[model samples]
Target: MINDQLMLLERAFLNSRAFPEKRYYSHVLWAPRTGSVATFPGLSNACSSATNTASGSAAWAEVQRQLSILVAALEGAAATLRPVAEL
Candidate 1:
């Protein structure tokens, strides 16, 4: 359920004109290195390598914590707005 909400939020962000000039599709494969596979380099290189680093879990945990807070805030806002929406 949380994953679904996250995906929906992601789609909303992607569909918005927040970064009107930026190409989100191409950005996924964009990297500084040459002759390297696009997404593979990001995962195998920085992603996997970070797991062994000292702050990897801490950083990820922090992000999860922040996301939960955001989700809760959104839920609260929706609840508050529901009464007004009914009119």
Candidate 2:
């Protein structure tokens, strides 16, 4: 189950990085007058605004943190699963 969850998180993280729109949880507007502007200015400032903040971005940051932890654990598990000849 843990492996399956890790795979799901890994796939999600890869997809987010692979796709242009998925890179940021907030909407990106391309305006000639304003140039390129982010609707929420990414997750770096998720806690800046109390009432007008983007909740999805904050949740995405937590998910990213969990994914990183899962990846490290999976790497350790993979090392243990390596063949004796390779160890």
Candidate 3:
């Protein structure tokens, strides 16, 4: 179960970071958004609002929705399997 939780957290984090082109877990890492934004230098502030803004991004919205669905599905599957596992 601990291994499963760790794997789920790993997957959730990777999905949250928006890196899905990976074919192998041993070869890919998630890039930090903070580091990406750190190089902006606070000049002009005219970067693409989707990647820069908090409330108007389609990527952010999809991440939220996908995570919610993932949580729901995982909980449902675990609930269904719990009683059977106990027996």
Candidate 4:
């Protein structure tokens, strides 16, 4: 439900050209040491949150986590859907 929306948004955000590219993917990994996108404070909190635990502070991380699940579902959906152009 809500997870689905988050994933789509995450995917788009990932592919977005204006996410303030930092260089390395590890930079993308949410953690206090590396910091986060200034414009995307939600992403920062999400990464700062304790591992495998939910927090009121890390709303974006929660969304990201949910998005990961949805991404898997998206992959499944993509597999099931036949390509009209190919047909």
Candidate 5:
């Protein structure tokens, strides 16, 4: 199940890259060669450090890793909850 979710996330990322102009999120934008930067309007100081230090591909890979961890955590938490009908 985790693998499936990760695959779907990867597909979405690819689609976003293919059509960047239509992207809804501006916090992170994909750029080649130079590292991708996070353009968080009000949160720039807090978020830019990490992305600015890494190369483009490295930054992207880290994002993917973090997303995978998040998905796994959400799935695991959901699995532990009882259905409302059971109450």
Candidate 6:
């Protein structure tokens, strides 16, 4: 389930770059009006479990890898919008 959501997010991020005119992609990543950030409860659980077991180290590493990708994508998207926001 988490993988599915991540895939969707990745696609959205890519689409946002391909079509800068679309605002929905940005909305999916962030909602300024409500001031709410997207949350993944399953990801939180995986992160917590990561610290509890040495056996899950590989899984933890993968999670961290995916998270880094997501973060970079978000930062890129935000950087693009910064100029507009400033004006």
Best-fitting candidate, measured by lDDT? 6
RMSD (Cα, Å) of model 6: 12.7
Using lDDT as the yardstick, the better of models 1 and 4 is 4
**Cα-based lDDT at residue 30, candidate 4:** 33
What does candidate 4 score on TM?
0.28
lDDT of each: 0.38, 0.38, 0.39, 0.42, 0.39, 0.46
* lDDT by residue (tens digit), candidate 4, 1-87: 445545543443332211223333322223223235553333444455544565554545565764464455446555444333432
Clashes of 5: 0
Quality of model 4 by C-alpha lDDT: 0.42
Q: What CA RMSD would you report for each candidate?
A: 10.3, 11.2, 8.8, 10.9, 11.4, 12.7
Model 5 TM-score on a 0 to 1 scale: 0.34
Answer with 2 or 5, whichever has the higher TM-score: 5
lDDT of 3 by residue, 1-87 (tens): 655555554443333223243333211133323234442211111233245567757656654554454455456545544433322
True-vs-predicted CA distance for residue 28, candidate 3, Å? 20
Q: Which tens-of-lDDT digit does each residue in 1-87 have in candidate 5?
A: 555555444343332332234465322223231223342121232234345665566545555544554455445445444243432
Question: What is candidate 1's lDDT per residue for 1-87, written digit by digit as tens?
Answer: 444455454333222221123434312223232223353222223434345557757535543443444455456445444433222
lDDT of 6 by residue, 1-87 (tens): 445455555454553332133455343233222112244322343456565668657758745654654576677555544433222
Clash totals in order: 0, 0, 0, 0, 0, 0
lDDT (Cα, 0-100) at 70 in candidate 1: 40
lDDT of 1 at 44: 29
Q: Each model's TM-score, in the order given? A: 0.33, 0.33, 0.33, 0.28, 0.34, 0.40
Candidate 5 off by > 4 Å: 1-56, 84-87
